[model samples]
Target: MSRIVSLTASVFAIGLFAGSAVAAGDTITIGIPVGLSGANSVVAPSVVQASELAVDEINAKGGILGKKVVLEVADDASGAAGAQKAYDLLIFKKKVDAIVAMETSAARNAGLPIVNRGKIPYIYTSFYEGRSCNPYMYINAWVPEQQVAPIVDYFNKQGAKTFFLIGSDYAFGRGMLAFTKEYIEKNGGKVVGDEYAPMDATDWTAVLAKVKAVNPDAIITSTAGGAPNVTLTKQLRAAGIKALYGNLAVDEGTARSMGADAEGIYIAGSYFTNIDTPANKSFLAAVEKKFGNDLKTPNELSVPQYEAILAYKAAVEKAGTTEAAKVVPALAEVSVEGPRGTIAMSKQRHAPLTMYLGQVKADGSVSIISSFKDVDPGEQCPKLK
Candidate 1:
């Protein structure tokens, strides 16, 4: 673990060179408004840390456009108002060259309108529902349609005829449930029950009892962070109700937090500790070296943030400029080898190319259940024209 954290720290140092070098007296700043506090803090710190690592690596490689990149971070505290304030500082006050991210969709949605109005290119790092197509924003994570589609298909193959849908009562959870419900019903499955819990809610006994009563073949949970997921799984096992469990938002980070309770639980995801690729091997080794075997990275979100910084660097080099107009197209067309495999970007969809799907096993390890396939931006996106 010390080695992994040190590696990330080294990368963060190198990434400082990613912004365009100030022309003698100029400064190139990158605004990052991430969840540094509040309910999502468990996931937020990693995103910020990973982004710093990406910046450090870029700076070490000589930076974008021969200019040094300076990363300026602000705590969104995982709320709408806080995120909006962070963007105001990054754009109007700090005047950064580009913005890297806002971790949650709610925060992004709260701040994106301001970013678009200013025409500052921003990269979003979390997987979200796909109804957005913004010229000024780039999405590096999977969409609901993309991530949830295959999970439903897998359940069908497993003979899961009835499912219970539970999620955080928010846009991301609700949107995921909507798309999943459509897909599952279309495939001849029934949603026996659907429930929503507040994002910060800790007690899930009521929801668990509701699930137990329904006794569906599977449960599709779309909550955020680690607490609810860990609590629910532990209590369910304590109650001895062990139906097949799958999660959309639960990742390795979440799994590790659950300890022995996370054993045997399955999570559909894009990457894991056990991936065999050369880059992934190096990544895992570095992480193990830094955080130790004790800190489990359950989700694939961190490495993607690392790749986005790299992808943005590559785009800046190809375009020969960091202007949004130049860099936007570069970002859309750029592809890079990532821990999860190849990530490609589309002009129409700000999010990068999607590939491969896997499931988290007991003992907090991940196994690939499906190979990479290009996921097209679904028709649900509002027209930009």
Candidate 2:
């Protein structure tokens, strides 16, 4: 199997590919596989921009290990096949030293085998289902425990006893809801309604009607990404159910896009554009300076991409090499100060971050209402061998 894999990689390297001639040690290439076009496109720009910001900062500081950092971007098209193809290109053709990815679980799962085969250090920068254990993979985003538990606790404390749950019919959505149900029940709350919609679902009339009928004390939604999230929020507001809406998938950028519809919605995550820390303020100012009037509001979903790149830089510098074997162990000890705070990678290859709970104000900006400091990922991934 190893011989066959090597032959295939050799063939790909010699084939007609744009970046196939890229030599190792010349530059530290970080591949970014994201939904540049498709259902997830709404948030993709922010992901790319944040990553670029990190690269610029690192390069300006004399690069990492005296080698300039560069990005090799590939469009995942919001699908599993696209992700697999993008990963193959990055690993076999472009020969990127590391990968910073933001995609759905299906896409990530599809690309995992390729990552394992190539032994490249892959940083998954997206809020996802718990327990994604892989030898060559690291997660820099919130897992279920870091994201759901705090929100559930906050809702329960606020007298939200009966909750309605809705999400896209996918691994991430279903898995998140499962954790949410457990947290709600553990907190002495009941799930009044549990439902799901397709990834591209646009109309929420039926779901809204059912939600009104259930009349839950709070509505917890994880509708996939982009248009689906916006559609669900808009329809919920149109229905005027008046129940507290707790959104696990809505980020600051998406909330701003929702405008008046986003008002009063609840969200919990590691970063928000309006977070009042000096580090956060400096990060936001840097973004504004780089992108100027074209800057999009940074969100929890996108900021992790920036943090992931920085984490990789720190690990590589500490390890004194970009080889996956050396960097993988160094990653466990690497710490980077992000907009959220000082985040360090755990032994399980996930970051422990500070979580914040906020409500979208009338102007579509988040108002921090509660904060959970230094929340550990407590990941279920098996220890790397």
Candidate 3:
């Protein structure tokens, strides 16, 4: 944590992101508040890379609304307490016009009220537990409807009648699995055991013991995104639990980093490197060229960060101003086609996402198994209008 803090201070001091917005003196500042330490640390680099690529591209072609754009980044350290500090530094101190972030659900929840008070356009770029609504906020990531259904439905088809559930015991972990449990029960599947550990719990021996005893046909986990995902998956493999494994929260980059431990496990997502679309190809090339060896693998968690920044730009263009009230509504009215396909958020304050069911290979690559297009985020703040 200290080393990360030092690195952040050095970047800011060196004027790394001080762009033409400085010389122009007329700029729209967009703050990126993401986790640089703790559970989200493993996935935050991908978000940072995607954000840098999108911002550089946007700035290259004139800036947003004829004003140069500047990005101010602060690390939330992956929890509620850290989020408050990150939000305060960006919102009150820097006075950014907008925020584009892919943060943990706890961090998002903690920072949202501050963003509202500051009255900036906030674009949340994480696939989360859902149902978070604010007048000035919009989300471009998957919810339970888009992400969980494919996994449950596919497992059911594979004759996975009995299952066990495990999670990080947080809002995202419990919330997603709650929906999974309901979905399983509704689909006539049975759950033998359901367990949750703390968000930061690294040791899963006891959890595996409980999981192993059930002997269910399948096991699904929803740990906190980065470190917990790695820890639990590694331990699950080491313990040789062997029931069919599925993850609701692991991103492609983390999955790949797990090596053999992640092989044969299943996940549902919105984007992958092998998307084979012109937009995705172009985006990937730009990121690779810009960051080169430092680039983290782009995945569902980070792709939406890039898209959200673009979508925010579109909303500002559509609204003809950066005022939160106007841009907020315009956000739902606009669309951005990026690596994940075209994303058109709804008046309900959520997007209709395209979902993919993928299985991780021995080398950490995910192979697509099935796809569902334009899945609606059901009833997420329907009264937002």
Q: Model 3, stretches more than 4 Å misplaced?
A: 1-16, 19-25
What is candidate 2's CA lDDT for residue 230?
Answer: 92
Better of 1 and 2 by TM-score: 2
What does the lDDT read for residue 146 in candidate 1? 66
Please list the Cα RMSD from the true structure of every candidate, rounded to 1 decimal place. Answer: 3.6, 7.4, 3.1
Of candidates 2 and 1, the better by lDDT: 2
**Considering every candidate listed, which one attains the maximal lDDT?**
3
lDDT of 2 at 145: 85
lDDT of 3 by residue, 1-385 (tens): 0011122344332223665337645788889898888899888877876787788888899989898777887889999999999999999988888999899889999998999799998999999988988888889998888899889888998999999999988899999999999999999999899999998899999989998888889999998899999999999889878788889999988888888999998999999887778988988888878766556788888899999999999999999998887898898889998988898887488988778899999988899998888888898997778
lDDT digits (tens) for residues 86-194 of candidate 2: 9999899878898889898878998999998889998898988878889888888888888887678777878899999999998888999999998888779999889
Each model's lDDT comes to 0.70, 0.83, 0.86
Candidate 2 minimal-lDDT segment of 10 residues = 1-10
